[model samples]
Every structure is written in C-alpha cells, then in structure tokens.
Target: MPKLRKAQVMILDGILSILMAMTISYVLFAAWPQHRETTGQLALERAGYDIVNAFYEDKEIYQTIRKGFEAKGYLSASEVEYLRTRLYNYGRMLGVSRIDVDIEGSEQFSVEVTHSTPARREQFTLIMPLRGGADDRIIRVSLWE
Candidate 1:
C-alpha cells in the first residue's frame, strides 16, 4: 500500500477527534438528567425522614399526637387538620413540594398537603410507630415533588 500524504493523514486525524468529542458529548448529555433525577429522589427521601423525625422530636407535635391517640384511639378531625397545617408549613420551609400523612391502627386516616404544584413522579415514605401505645399504630409520611 502507498504511504498516506501528510494532508490526508491530518484530515483523518481531525475527523477522528471530532467524532470522539461528539461521542463524549452525547454520553454526558444522556447521563446528566438521570444523575440529576437520582439526586432529587435522594433529597426527597431525606426530607421524608426528617419530617417524621421532626414530628416525633418536637414536644408540641408529640403531645398533640399522643393526646389524639389517648383520647379516641385515633386522631380527631380537628387534630388531623392542625397536623396537616403544621406539617405542610414545615415542609414548605424545607422546600418540600408535597406531603401525605397516613396514620393506621384500628382505623386509617390520611391527609394530603401541597405547598406547590406537584411536578415529580418519585415518592419517598417513612414508616414510624407511635410510642406508648398498646395498639400498634403506625404513622407513614410520604414526601414527593
């Protein structure tokens, strides 16, 4: 085979470099959105856990829940409403998009509170048991965008 001319070799090298750059760009563009989505989902999960911990840790919130549990074996409508408001406010302060709370024991109650328009499809749930209860009452906190 004849040796390649310098000009032809340089042209081939330029084309190869261009193709490599395009391939790299395409891979980065394809993977970036997925990485961002995974990060968002992780943040939501952490927010859900924090919300549950906040409820259990705060004296006022803990007392409110305990009062409801002791009084009627379930949360009263007003108590539930208060909790919805309080939780929604707290979640908003933390930049959470939407929150749904579910309490289940002998009865099941649920509340959905939205701080803003729901945009994301991913959801994170935190399940926690109420303390000092003879019944197995579980509180489920769900956070989503």
Candidate 2:
C-alpha cells in the first residue's frame, strides 16, 4: 500500500473515531430494556406487578413484601387508582389503561398484559398457578408513546 498523506490520514482517523464512538454508545445503552420516563407512573406499574409477584404469585417462600409496597412512600393513592383502572375482569381484554393478553403460548397456555397511557405494554414474567405447576409469559406488549 502507498503511504498516506498526513491530511488524508487525519480525515480517515476522524471518521473511524466517530464510527467507533457511535457503535460503543449504541452497544452500551441498548443492552438493557427501557424504564419509564416519569417516576410516579413507573412506580405505580412496578408496585402493582411487584405486589402480585411478591404476594400471590409465590412459588417459593419468602418474607412478605406486601406492606413495603403498601407503605405511603413506595406508592401513592394515585398509583393505586392507576392499578385498579388497569386491571380487568376475567375474560376481558382492553388497552384503555388496562391489561390484555396480547399473545398466547403453545398448548393455549400464556399470559397477557396491557397499559393504555402510551400503547400496548408487556413484561417478562413467570407465572405459577395457585394450585401447582408453573407457566412462563410468552407474549408481552410495549407502550408505543
């Protein structure tokens, strides 16, 4: 190869550096899933789901986490209201601030969740029936906004 001139070398180096920086940044930030922007809304969603998984969905034994989320600091009444509004009755599906089973699993076993404020929303979850056995959430929704 021919020896490169100083100006050409500097230009190539600049382009390479910019590309490397962009690639590094994308890799670093893209690894983890997204978190909600507003703390209150996020807190409400986390608190609701956490409450369920901690309290009712336990396949294993552990110290109760109910009271902690119920405490005034971790969650607020608005959050409670938000959760209440989001939950739906059996055999009902809606996205107007509600949960929906957007997808099903093979053998007709699956889980569904929905959040209306943004768009369809979902979470990666493990579900254990109250009686016995365990199920995994297959299809999860995401907020569009």
Candidate 3:
C-alpha cells in the first residue's frame, strides 16, 4: 500500500466529519415532528389541568357545584347549563374550540361545551375530585384543539 500525503489524509478526515455532521443534522430534523407532537400533547394536558383547576379554585363555581350536590345528588339542568357556558368561554380564551366535560357521580353526565367543525385528532384528559362531596365524585375534562 502507498502512504497518502498529509494533505490527502486531512481532506479525508474533513470529509468524514462533514458527513457525520450532516447525518446527525438529518436525524434531528427527521425527529422534529415527533418532538413537536410530544410538546403539543404536553401543552394540551397542561391546559386541561388548568381548566379543571380553574373550576376548583373559583369560589363561586365551586360553591355552585357543591350546592348542587347538596340539593340533589347530581348536578341539575341549570347548573349543567352554567358549566357549559363557562367552559365554552374558557375554551375560547384558551384557543381550544373543542371541549368535553363529564361529571360522574350518582349519574354520568356528559356535555360538549364547544364543538369543532373538523374534529381534532389530539386530546388530553384531566380527572379531578369534586370537592365538598360525601361520595367519591369525579369530573373528567377532555380538551382538544
């Protein structure tokens, strides 16, 4: 075998390094969508959690639901309507057009606050305890863009 000149060896190393960098860049670019999807899912999950937390944190809303539970074992029609309106407004503020809320207690009640023209593919759910209730009542909030 013939020994290569110093310049030729350097050129070969440079070419190899460039190829390695390009491969790495391509891999990262190819994986970008997956990373974005994961981030989007996380944001949706956070938004769901925030919406549920908002319901819990607001004294008026909390009292209304608790009052409903006290008056009737489950939410009344009026109370459900109020929730629907509030959720719809909140969804608009969050830039999420589709939201579904399910309250499970003595009876299972489901309500769709805002309807998306074209259904969203991504969704996130948050399950929270209904405070001030004797029984184990849970509110499930599902959000989609």
RMSD in order of candidates: 6.6, 14.9, 7.6
Residues 43-113 of candidate 3 have per-residue lDDT tens digits of: 66667767877777866667667778777767788887777677777777776757766666634444454
Worst ten in a row by lDDT for model 1:
30-39
Give candidate 3's error at residue 51 in angstroms: 0.8
TM-score of 2: 0.26
Model 1, range 17-46, lDDT digits (tens) per residue? 998887898787753324333577677667
Clashing pairs in 2: 101-112, 120-142, 121-141, 122-141
For each candidate, give its TM-score against the true structure: 0.63, 0.26, 0.59
lDDT values, one for every candidate? 0.66, 0.38, 0.65
Regions of candidate 3 where Cα sits further than 4 Å from its true position: 1-39, 106-115, 121-133
* lDDT value, candidate 3, whole model: 0.65
Give a tens-digit lDDT track for model 2, residues 35-98. Answer: 8575555644554454344324442211111222323213344443333334332113322243
Question: What is the RMSD of candidate 1?
Answer: 6.6
Find the candidate with the highest TM-score and give its number.
1
Q: Which scores better on TM-score, 1 or 3?
A: 1
